[model samples]
Target: MASAPGNNLPVFYNDLIPLSSVDHAGYRSRTLDSAPFLATHHAVPLTVDEFVSAQRFLPIIFSAGDEPVPLALMGLNEGVNTFVDDQGKLRGPSYVPAYVRRYPWMLAKLRPDSDELSLCFDPTSEALGAFEDGQALFEDGKPSDLIQGVLKFCEDFEQAAGRTGQFMKDLKDLDLLMDGEVAIQVPGNEQPFVYRGFRMVNEEKLRDMRGDQLRKISQNGMLPLIYAHLFSLQLMRELFEAQVTQGKGPVSVTPAPEPAQA
Candidate 1:
């Protein structure tokens, strides 16, 4: 259901095809030196499992929609990824979200009615296909060790995604999510660049939560994740600076949102 028609696959995926030994006996999985798909993409989905590591570098925000998914902002503005160059090469040491690392490969359900997910990959990826010199996907018409490892990784990612869904549900059930906004003032300008179009854990709600509610979430390890997200917002300014440094600032300045009343 996630994938739409006519090559409308997930982010970084141009086209997806189920992996099978019968059809891909000669296929090989190659090491990608660069990721062109990520060059222009600014936001990447993140799992709760990656909250701690991802918060150190990227601002984790929830997507603005009915099904809110956590996203690590590679850049504050759209199509302005400051971490990677135009060729999709990393410019500095940073934490790469597993969603990006698992790109070109994912476990997706092939049919709407079935719950069984199959190992699928983007056929357009330069790192995968019938390559002459790369890790073989199959050996003697059977899944090779390389395929086994890839399948395991995809499975783990799926599990993490499930946990992330539950995390979002918990936040919603507690009424802790609120529209997110960040205003960063430029040195020479009176008006700050205000960014919105995302959601964040409402710190006020969290603080005002009852004792038993707090204890329950804290014991379940949700407290730390919420704190990680709240703390990650501080990096938005850093991300904006990176965009300016990379000469990829937003095309137009947006008016700052009204400040909240104390």
Candidate 2:
């Protein structure tokens, strides 16, 4: 299950194995006891479908890259997740990203040239194996109900991804995204700590949009998503306070570097 450095695998997924009746006939999937694996990630990928619920807890932002993805920030600092304790236990009630809930199993293209995707699971995950206490992956050499459900979930996620991609493209085409930064002043600190490394919708630009364009965005159901993101920004201070409470606060007061432009 070891992965080489520079592998683009998502967090906690060391290796992906395409599920096959012949190769994984005896495999079984079990319920996970905890999500300590998510402790190392400060942000998790999100779909636009999650904006409403997710906005209530975590601050949502877009990562800066060629293929920017929406993300839910669990913490302000790199590799520091205030929501998860050192023991990997979640601290309080919060919205869990679908990306995290779908972990240990994902849809992947098995070949570079193939457009079709296959259901794959992490070979290193302890929640899967030929165990007595879980659901079987196959029955009579065919996929079991459990596998079918997983496949359905993956399919739905892919569809959501397509929608999210189009949404991002629309934002880009409208030139709504701008470099974003936030500052937090901790107790006993004269200087405020600044965090960056992300992009956000420019509210001023959004407001300046023509009435017809606004109507178009509203009709597409994107107006609420934009508002949700803007509302979530208020949580950045709360997240920073959580980090301070957890003793994982940033040590330096320097402003974060500008994120690489896509």
Candidate 3:
């Protein structure tokens, strides 16, 4: 895709190429042996469709920016994913965001001027290549069933993204999003550790909304998603504890002692 540098690229996709039958006739897709690709990501984009199930496991929050995207928090710090261990094995059972499962394959526009999107794959991904024992990407100059399935998944993800965009727009239109902050008091600590840098639905505003407005949101299936997000906030502390268990919690900053008697 012809996007600005570093704009279109998702996590772990070093290079993306349009999958053409002529150019990739000999290419094959391999099964994921490990998930080391996810070790560096503390959060992954989540679709609105996933909010209900994902909220059961991970805390769902919105990224802070013009285009706010829902994220499933895997950890609280940079380059740390409490869910994925050093060996790339999941620490426990949790909902895996479709964004992570769709890695190595994505839909992208071949040219900036083109309105049609094409199936693209990460050329740098070890999960896909010309392997001896793997599913072929193409057969008889046509995409194989495996490729077809991946394409279908990408299409579904696009649809979900559209719905997610609308959900975010509704939240914005209602002015319900607010700066997300949390304070957790660690045992034996005098001050509570504060966390910020995400956006969340303003429960106060939501509660104060008119009955007609609330009914409209509920009828459109957005009220549940909103409540899911609100409920997921409780997991933030759990995530922090996971980080602490993994030795990636907040660093202790010793307070400076008062000089003599001043």
Candidate 4:
């Protein structure tokens, strides 16, 4: 028999794969209670590939769906870093493809019955809970510490490219989600990656950042904030796409950020 939502099984004790139940206390899934949620409603999915590409949601892949998709992982993250060609060499960022940005909603629209499927408001409730927890840790730890930690991430990458650095010096001013003040575009084209009212980064500072920023950093290029913000919006696209693929119910998730650690 199986256990409740947040209890029992998969324990650990030094070095032992026991035949019996282990009952680890720390391992628990995130909450997906039936609460009223406020998310974007998608009567019709968008038409952009960056919108539904698997590479964008690598950071939160486990949380995107209850069950896993049978595709290989790409872009930047732990677990299966690079893609191989006939020669068995790691491919570059070209793995995602230039066309995805133009057809973002293809994955969700692949199934004709997308409207019948429900959205996953809290697929990786546990991971979302952890991010909320991490936020609170930053909030309570120290402003200086929090700012330094984030800035260090940006500054380190910038310096690793054989250059000196200036510091960000503030987090309150560092939106990192703002569109900044530039427009990035693919070569031979004037328009940048846009959805509804959102746009990808087109500035300089963020283009150098790594991780999610690196993934979203198009060949057209933009700054850091664009990467962070656009990555988030892309995740929503994937979440909706998952619904269409699985044929679930209306989307919803628990609202409040997870409680801070004591």
On TM-score, the candidate that comes out on top is 1
| Model 4 lDDT tens row, 30-99 | 2322211101111111112222343354211111122111121231211112232323232334233221
For every model shown, what is its TM-score relative to the native structure? 0.92, 0.91, 0.91, 0.21
Q: What is candidate 4's CA lDDT for residue 253?
A: 29
Instruction: Kindly list the per-residue Cα lDDT of model 3 for residues 26-71, writing each as its tens digit.
Output: 9988887568888977878888999999999998888876667788
Off by over 4 Å in 3: 1-8, 252-262
Instruction: Kindly report which residue pairs in candidate 1 clash with one another.
Output: none
Better of 1 and 3 by TM-score: 1
Candidate 1 TM-score, true structure as reference: 0.92
Worst 10 residues of 3 by lDDT: 253-262
lDDT of 2 by residue, 113-204 (tens): 66777788888888898788789999999999999999998888878878888999999988899878888876788988887878899999
Better of 1 and 3 by lDDT: 1
Candidate 1 lDDT, 215-250, residue by residue in tens: 999999999999999999999899888888778876
Q: What's the lDDT for residue 117 in model 4?
A: 19
Tell how far residue 81 is off in model 2, in angstroms: 0.8
Quantify all predictions' global Cα lDDT against the true fold: 0.81, 0.81, 0.80, 0.25
lDDT of 4: 0.25
Model 2 / residue 139 / CA error / Å: 1.6
Candidate 4, 106: how far from true, in Å?
39
